[model samples]
Target: MSLINRLLLLLLACAAPLPATPSDLPLKVGLIGLDTSHVIAFTGLLNDKDNPSHVPGATVTAAYRGGSVDIPASINRVRGFTTTLTEKYGVRIYEDIAKMCEEVDAILLTSLDGRTHLEQVRPVLAAGKPVFIDKPVAGSLKDAVKIFQLAEDAGVPCFSSSSLRWYPGVVEVATADFGELRAALSYGPATSEPHHPSLFWYGIHAAEALFTVMGPGCQSVVATESSGAIVVTGKWNNERIGTLHGIRDGKTSFKVTAFGTKAIVEQKSGGNYAPMLREIVKFFQTGKPPVPAKLTLELYAFMEAADESVRQGGTPISIPDYLRRHGQTR
Candidate 1:
């Protein structure tokens, strides 16, 4: 080749756009449910460029309007939120989840009703997409266990968690340099849903925060109810005690008090969803769950055991026996 031609070729190669790097290409994300306000908050954070708290690694490109008619909370606001997703954020709506899965790289199972999560996630797992299930992984413990097993069998990464787990204060309580954590107390609003256990709905926030401070090995759970709240006490493996107070009446908020050998600290401040969204984005990018499936299953088991305790008149329920009865050895 002539020198001039070679120089021209080199210039063109240099000027041509480099193949997009992984960091340059954002992952395409799909939403499985539109009933909850999380759809709006999450979409705005992920899709709206002007939003102050926008998370940049992924964009919500598609969604499925999955709502339960039996639950007023699920059915009433789904339409409005669906409209907002389409009109405000320009996200495509898919009537079928599998089809949406075909288009997006990852799935966010945000359905307000936990019962639908198992069935909805089946198609997502079939497509081999990484999924992040919102709180209450399933309506029941058995279903939650099965969901994780299915994802594991499929070799697809999956996880479920409450945003409170990543709250600044909660993280501090969980990871501070204080002497070993001896006990913890987490309290928050836990309104009961007739379809779900009392703690599965809103109380998962506090429950998750509790587990954050005291990493999972709850051997026993006992719950008692009063007019004001339903209190659950858990015994960890190392004799570390953790308590979750599910407020039923009057003013309610999330707080965690950690009792360490060196000092005691309480987190009364609140946080927004942005921190958790960042973790979700990172999980989608890496195809790794921020929270392990086994740990999440154990958390659900803890909540289910609380229900069993109430059923047995506040008798302490054994976590191992509870998991074995539900066909979950792990």
Candidate 2:
């Protein structure tokens, strides 16, 4: 037998067989968003009427609570989306999250703001189903940690991402064997979701790209905003340094660069969504979390603590103490 086959046999020698693709089977996917606009992308997907191209084999099937009623208008964007959702996806907006979770095998929680993720997603986790959270996973590091830990303990997978992370160049750089990567620089459009979570929600698109390639163990980070431009500097084990820029009105609208002692690589994969979805499908097939939930929580740890510093007159905060106080200093 070939070396590959022998290795595979040895690895799965006593493991259980994987599941058959319920790919073509009628899978029910629910979307939890106050504004139907969030689900509109999938609703009008490829003009196929069923979002067949992306979610192949699985049907979005049902969408609930197509409208937001209880939340204050100051925080709600659901009004503008009702018509599109009803006309495009035939989704019904329900008030109770428990009821919503019971009806679907999987959920797409696209709440209007990051602050609302914890309240909305907890029920979904308790229901024991997989979830895909749109960026800005949670409002705080503590909350993000709780969310992942809950899902982890429950054996329910949750994933969140940005299109930029999968851009061709970023993927290529990620494959590098950088020896002690000294620094990484990633740039993206001005984050519109800053009010809820400054660079917390959207910044991860760039941060996650770096975090993935860096392979975790980020010690702390500091960010400075000058005239609405965010300049983020971070350290990993106090050895390698990285920067992430969220700039407005910049012509060089996209870039991700990684550096090493022996090699350097640069690539630009701007605004790609297909890769994000493809990864999710892979997670379902393998029944595994898409990325290191622990690592993701750590990145959130950085963002949350950094934001606190920003609020405290640019004072630096130690993420380790914060995590340790919460008993999460892993």
Which candidate's TM-score is highest? 1
Model 2 sits at a Cα RMSD from the real structure of 9.3
Clashes of 2: 7
What is the C-alpha lDDT profile of model 2 across 125-147, one tens digit per residue?
88887888877787667777777
What stretches of model 1 exceed 4 Å from their correct place?
A: 1-23
The alpha-carbon deviation from the true structure for residue 218 of candidate 1, after best TM-score superposition, in angstroms, is 0.6
Error of 2 at 166 (Å): 2.1
CA RMSD of each candidate after superposition: 2.3, 9.3
Give all TM-scores, in the order shown. Answer: 0.94, 0.80
Residue-by-residue lDDT tens digits, candidate 1, 152-228:
88999999999999999999878876698899999999888899987899989999999999997989999998778
Best by lDDT: 1
